[model samples]
Target: MGTLEGRLKGKVALITGAARGQGAAAARRFAAEGAKVMIADVNDAEGKALAGELGDPAAYAHLDVAEEDDWAQAVDRTVAEFGTLNVLVNNAGVLHFSPLGQTTLADYERVIRINQVGAFLGMRSVVEPMSTAGGGSIVNVSSVEGLAGMPFLVAYTASKFAIRGMTKVAALELGERGIRVNSLHPGMIDTQMVSDAAGGAEVDFSRVARRLALQRVGRPEEIADVALFLASDESSYCTGGEFVADGGATATHALKL
Candidate 1:
């Protein structure tokens, strides 16, 4: 295949949870598309290493998504390093699996803080800067659970649903300022987050894939591609939309014979 043209040229982006997994994939894609990227995460070593790999156009910022101050610093650093912030990908999140009754308040709050509150802070922090830059895109990485409830994922589902709702609200409020906000819902992605949720064991997605329309699990790169489209001007007409990259998992209503 021929090399793809730069779709994000002249853009500056900050992506949370970019040390690894889907966030890292999106960071790489953005850089490849000619965007100056800030790989923000708490994982310093990996984030810095990825920045080095991506060379001059990318840098790493230490960001603990749950902390408001960290969000401020990350956004400031991105603008300081790259001139302005044109894209913000709220991709940092946490997952906890347990029966609703068994889930502790502490665990539930932790998930909410990172997955929901974190995105909120990110959006708020970027608004002014993005508006000054003449508008930008904010991609909130939600999940399939955001659209529907799943067993043993109460906290995660709640947080994702919050992100989905927040995305719409931000889009509506920010549209006048030329900023676009959208949510991405990915399902059964092969990432470390899923492995950790599965108790550090490999996630056997074979059975789950059988129920989906595509009959396969998704890759982090696939979701990254969708994010790329949303971040680039190609999706200028899209805002407050739920862009699902789930292998068609949400296309059916669970009906058994």
Candidate 2:
């Protein structure tokens, strides 16, 4: 009968790509739950606006995920602003649709650098502060594509799969240090990243939604709930695990029409 109040009270979090979409949703939830949040993203305007809207509970930081210096600065700012860093949600990523033969090395590396390498840097950067704070959680935002292959997504698949694997490795290595690492796999969430990747082309998710068991595309706020759980102590015993939030998309078999 008790309300879920202050679930993240006294906690501090840094979320990448938080200017909008799922990351932004998580930011709002974290703030409402009594956590200090840092909205880290390359989108300066939106990031700053979100931080302002969230008031003192949030701050904006410009972070180009693939850059080491940017990672360092973002981590430092989170600690300096919030007094400690207790959680990190590596939610920054770009989706690219390209055939295997046509996928450029440049494009492949770009996806890997942001989605894959960005998570790597985030985990590495937070260990020291999080350990000093006595413990923390790392939520790497992967995709259902990480679990299985999808057409025209070789690079994105590779990056998400790497995130899934790296999460396990980090969990094993960091458990003794009081840090928990896990991967979050979301399927077909309605977000701007897809449209942006398509060069502002209008996307029709109704067709895709029809194939889902839920028969609808996901919402960013939905995934934010899962991220909130993983970030909170509610998932204390849940490290090195895959937390999937797909709409039963993965439940189908190859023979499905």
- RMSD in Å for candidate 1, one decimal? 1.2
Query: For model 1, what is the alpha-carbon lDDT of residue 170?
Result: 96
Question: Residue by residue across 124-216, what tens digits does model 2's lDDT show?
Answer: 999999999999999999999999999999999999999999999999999999999999999999999999888899999999998999999
lDDT of 1: 0.93
Tens-digit lDDT string for candidate 1 (104-188): 9999999999999999999999999999999999999999999998899999999999999999999999999999999999998
The residue ranges of model 1 lying beyond 4 angstroms of the native Cα positions read 1-4
Kindly provide the TM-score of model 1 when superposed on the true structure, using C-alpha atoms: 0.98
- Alpha-carbon RMSD, each predicted model: 1.2, 1.3
